[model samples]
Target: MLSAGFIVAVVFSWIYDITPGGIIRTEPLPKQKLPLINKKVKTYRFTTFVSVIIIIGLLSFNIIDSASARKIEKIDKTIAVLPFTDILPIKYESIVFDYIGNQITAGLSKIDDFNVLPWRSTKNFRKGNKDYVKMGDEMDATILVDWKAIEIEGEKRLTIEMIVAEDEKILWSNDYSIKNSWTEISVISTEISRNIARRLRTFLSLEERARINEIPGSPTALYNAYRGRSIAQNALYLYEMGNRKTDLSDFDVAIDLYTQAIQVDSSFAEAYANRAVTRLWGIYTTHYSGNELEKCLEDIEKAKSIDSNLIEADIAMGFYYYYGKRGFDNALKYFQQALEKDPANVDCLFYLSLVHRRKGNWDEVAELSSQALENDPASALFYINIGTSYDYLHDFEKAIECHNLAIAILPEWPA
Candidate 1:
């Protein structure tokens, strides 16, 4: 009976071990299927975050690049030609004096990166005084060329002095004397121009030289242009100094002079531009109707079409767009285009800053105005713009500083 009972016990144990319920089952722990999460979906989310980061980095880089480009665009350097003095004592030989001056101005203007004051303006200043410092200050000239010619016996002895000035102080002065026959005057003038260009190159950078040399024309065409330019320039001077009410007779004469210049050379861009300027002035200052404005635009467009690179055309167009039509967009476009053609275009930069200020872009106004000041350090207008920009930004200290600088430069302007 004991053996039988043991045997039954062993069989029952075997039966329990073989049963599916009695087997060591895992209790089916809620069938945890890893929360049904997809590995690829998580990978896609991570990849999207990385792509967004890359896109932001690219955008930031573009923004920085654009800012840097604008900053580079603002850099400009300029040089000037002072009035050529005639030391000749012959009163009737004033024509010769003007001839020599015209030659010198023409040669220098042909050199790249030079912002030569027109013969008209220089002649006007020279008519009043011979002080180099005062003339340089009035014209905002960086370099001054003072010339004297004495007719000795039958030969002409010319004395030329190149004076470099900064802040009314002469930095460097060099004197050169040349003796030549009447026929050799052009050769002598060419030599003088070459020497002055060399000296300018020494004082100026390579980029500046490139700018001066970029104008397109043959030597003969350039010389002829200068002749025509001198005529128009002299007329412009007469117009500027003459009063419209008291000098209406002179105005007619000045207009005739300008017309004569165009007759001398139909391709003379400066003459056209200056005539347009004079007409526009009449519209602005006199009883002229809007007809003058339309005619001015037509002449300027003609001038630009003749020579797309004419700086005067660019400036006149910029003025027409900015002040006449009040089209700031077109104004800015022409100004920027002019700047691209000649980085040292002070007028373009000046008006560009003004446009920025009018648009309420204080930072851009400050930047462009400061750049204009650098290009034309003696310009009171630049200082005024700078001060205005600072005032707009509510930086009273800087505004005051700019105002003081402006007053120091041009004490005649009202604060």
Candidate 2:
């Protein structure tokens, strides 16, 4: 329509002249001026009109495209939980920062509509430059959660905000007092997650609400269990980073912490499940001296008896089949079940990818590894696995690209 209107206007102007007296037919130019008139028409009139219309069209398109992008970004539910900034004294930083951040992330991961990136994905933004907009863009997250800790007398308080990643608009903000107990952390984190979900306009299933709200074991036992978990995860990260001695020492300490939690609360299913996995890792790393497999199975059974739907227990069972018995089929089944419960879980996704690789399902391996990387972008193992899958599928270019990404992330480890 616009082009047609422009053409009509051009033809009308060519055929008639508008003047103060009246509209009149355009008279033929004198012979002396004919060349100049022709030159003006040929050199500028046609080309200039078309160029102006084209520029207007292009500008309109860009404006529409940018508006559409902003609209989509506004509704995108992808979230990245940034590390909690601690303003307390040096001795109180890591424990408060890591535990609260991790618990909040776990709580948010239970929401079905939220693509909650794992804590590792946002670890790089903990210190130094704290630009939420840039961080969200780099992580491909539309929502960014920020947290800050302040000490008030003997206790600590946390201020949190869920922001629109594009513009740092606060979608939701709240503050909670932190007590010296795991139950308090659990309750506070769950509340914050629920608020964020509500702001995003997503309803939680009964099962998800129950899972996020579950406060298990005595306060002391829960504290020990979480501390053990933190240690075990750090040790595992170190092991992956080429620290060979991590399994021998740090795993032992983590296992002992879990043991303490179990002693305090005999029915702490999560602690049992965590211990089972840590024990299995010890066996996998060839650092175990006793019957770690038997112990792992016993813990799995104990955890199931305590809470049949415990995801940690299910994940432990999956790893048991994978690491202890090499039963890829069973591992796949258990991991799939866990994945269905917590679709964005990095551990479940990684374990499923590993099982698929063993079962010669290269496509499934690549797909699951890619999903794992979405949650854990900093994990070189996921990139390496993806590269391996591509190599098996004979896509050498993609394989090399993935390998290079892994190498870039961890130059110390040979991709």
Candidate 3:
């Protein structure tokens, strides 16, 4: 109330004068015209004028600040890729569709013009008849990549469209027919990237253009590598899809897919790491014993040997130490290392929080879980972790608030 009265008094004094004899007078302020300055004679008028001008300037600055924020929001270089609709008779052709989607996303990620949403982030939208606009809004993206694929005889037909999320307008569309070979997928991806980049009119440097046309060493090597890469990608797609089932069957299908990936690419470190992660899950369920455990450890070690800097390998090590060896400190160390490599990684932050939770470090748990939500806000697990941390800290109100947020994101889950 005191602050409010002070403000009101200041505002009233801006256009009036007060005398020492307790009289309020409506006296016009005298101005002395001195060269480039019309200086006010009264101290109150000078101060009030300066205050009013400052207030007006602040209001103008706020208006511009709001407008600039809106402009920045509309100028986001973000896009979401919906899983390509497969209209083939073969049910298993879903893998091909997924692989094609992956290739296009990977190709576009190479361009500096836009950011492609991760597959994990978009896969959950495969429920019901998804509204493109809602998905785009949820992802905070301006563009949506809606695509479809059809396999006819020995050729594949692909159709892709870019929709402006705000107005549901088609920004660009293309239809292409090519040989149903693995190499052809990359060809389609590059052509689509080039066409979309041109439509966006983003200034592409010479080097970026050159990347769009990069070729393999030789035709023979290109054929094998592309084919192997697609096979591995499709297998990974299967693994990811199956892993969402929330049952032991997830391990079954994901392991088979990883095996297929290894068969196609003998030196695939990522495939090894993914397989080892599933194996770790199996161990947690008491499904792997003796020789099987040894094999899983070998796979984890082999993945680290192949790629010393693989984040997935680091995550696998973290999990191995936590679940298999019961070494919480070592697990936390590796998880922290992985988080350092990719601070925005959802799994890294969540798993690191899990370790903190185990150690009864409620502060650390809350911090890590909150950080995970920064990258993947839709993750109900992270919210749950935060709620659990609050619960441990005896903050029931905050715990309830965090749980409410989790419930809002995943209403069906009774966490």
Q: What is the TM-score of each candidate against the true structure?
A: 0.52, 0.72, 0.64
Q: How does model 3 score by TM-score?
A: 0.64
Model 3 spans > 4 angstroms off: 1-74, 85-90, 93-99, 109-113, 126-135, 181-198, 201-250, 377-390, 393-412
- Model 1 weakest lDDT span, ten residues long: 71-80
User: What TM value does model 2 have?
Assistant: 0.72
lDDT of each: 0.60, 0.78, 0.69
Candidate 3 residue-wise lDDT, 244-340, digit = tens: 3344454566677676656666666767776777777767655565346676778888888888888888998898888888899999999889989
Q: Global lDDT for candidate 2?
A: 0.78
lDDT for 91 in candidate 3 is 45
Residue 385 miss distance in model 3 (angstroms): 4.6
Error of 3 at 151 (Å): 2.8
**Could you tell me how far off, in angstroms, the CA of residue 160 lies in candidate 3 after the best superposition?**
1.5
Give me the displacement of residue 154 in model 1, in angstroms: 9.8
Predicted model with the maximum lDDT: 2
